[model samples]
Target: MKNIFKLSILGLGLALTLASCSPEDPIGSKVTYYPLITVNGDDFMSVEEGGTFNDPGAVATIGDEEVPVTTTYEGRFRGQTYNSTLGTSVADLYTASYAATNEDGFDGVATRTIYVGNTGDLVTSIEGLYRSTVTRNGALTAQYTDMEYVLIWKNSDGTYEISDAFGGYYDLGRAYGVGYITPGGVIVANDIPTNNFSFPGTQYNSGFGAPSEITAMTVDPATNSIDLTVVWTTTTTYTFQIHLDQVQL
Candidate 1:
């Protein structure tokens, strides 16, 4: 009886292990990787200084903790460093942690979907209509709500021009006081405000700024979707991660 019970337990363990394996997802029962995003019908690749391949992958941050992803590059995890070379295709849904990387590299978990590619999809490439919300901190007390404007991006030359004909507003105010004394009365004071008006707030605010540099771009062979990250250097540094489902017209 004892031998039968031990055999039964061992067989159940083996069955469970076999059930967890699949030919389709040899890595596990389910595949884990990154989603792809395409822009302008192009597959973006992560290249080096001379546009050389960098073994694209991704990164994710949950709360204040950053969870680095595993890819074809050398990465450190749990204080141990390891290198991941390119190999067979993996799963799309990563283990429920903080982050996952497929072919795209160093992107936030929130920005992961932008990298997931679809066939023949190209990204917007920081051109055409792009709106950014501008906020000021420390000394400057102002907020520009959803500044909409037309943008012309020069990816190769690394420059961009913006035209937001609609001018914004700057609040201004002042104070005045007057005092009068009568023969038999004490002093009387009065203050009056004189200027009060509004501006049309539409003017040609033309300026040229360095266009965002495309640090990385890639496309899946299966799905032609492209994923890219454009880093913009302005008075206020800003980063825009782009994933275009289709090429911009």
Candidate 2:
């Protein structure tokens, strides 16, 4: 009986010892890992007008394992018709959005800007003389009448001269400016020097300045006509729609 009692005590002690040495439950202390997603390839791309855009695709990963990801794309472009007058092609700007999502609910998004331009020189394509008309609609609409007969001279060196001949005659002494066309088919006008000039009968000088801006320009090669939008600001902003026909110099 004593031997059996000792065996029972030994077994109980062994059980308690095993219980103490065993690992604790780690449910609350476990760390959860999440998958990461990334887009692959250039964030900016360019294509010719009506050209095909090939997607380079993307990848996702969790630790050393590559996870499968789904991708989607969205695109936007200005719907301008091709110009036939000048035999020049109209350039268009397009933006594409790429998105990737992993099974772990993690996602990534990337954007690319595409410029569809003609194969011609950007500088030579925009050089010419243009006639502009101004219209006002916001805040100070009725305070001014439509101004006509504005002139723009786009020179070969990417420099331009503007004459705000409000009543069919040049006034403000022609403000000199510089500008460039982007690969994405956008025209950016840089700041022109501020000029102080007096009207024909005025004794005091009035200050005239040009605003830096990005405007839309379309070329029609067939008609030799270029359509452009110019935004000018002084005390208030004025938008001018210009139709430039290459004056047979």
| Winner by lDDT | 2
Span of 10 residues, lowest total lDDT, candidate 1: 177-186
Q: Report lDDT (Cα) of residue 149, candidate 1.
A: 20
Measured with C-alpha atoms, the lDDT of residue 237 in candidate 1 is 54
**Candidate 2 wrongly placed segments (more than 4 Å):** 1-35, 76-96, 117-119, 122-249
46 Cα displacement, candidate 1 (Å)? 30
lDDT of 1 by residue, 2-31 (tens): 999999999999999998884664453643
Tell me the deviation in Å of residue 92 in model 1: 35
lDDT of 2 by residue, 1-249 (tens): 999999999999999999999998776554434555565677655455445656565565666677665543322222342211111132333444444455555565555554443332222443333333323232223212222222343334454333332211113112221111111122323422111111111111123443423245555655655455555455776654545454332
Ten residues in sequence with the least summed lDDT for candidate 2 = 196-205
Listed in order, each prediction's TM-score against the native is 0.19, 0.33
How many steric clashes between backbone atoms does each model show?
35, 17
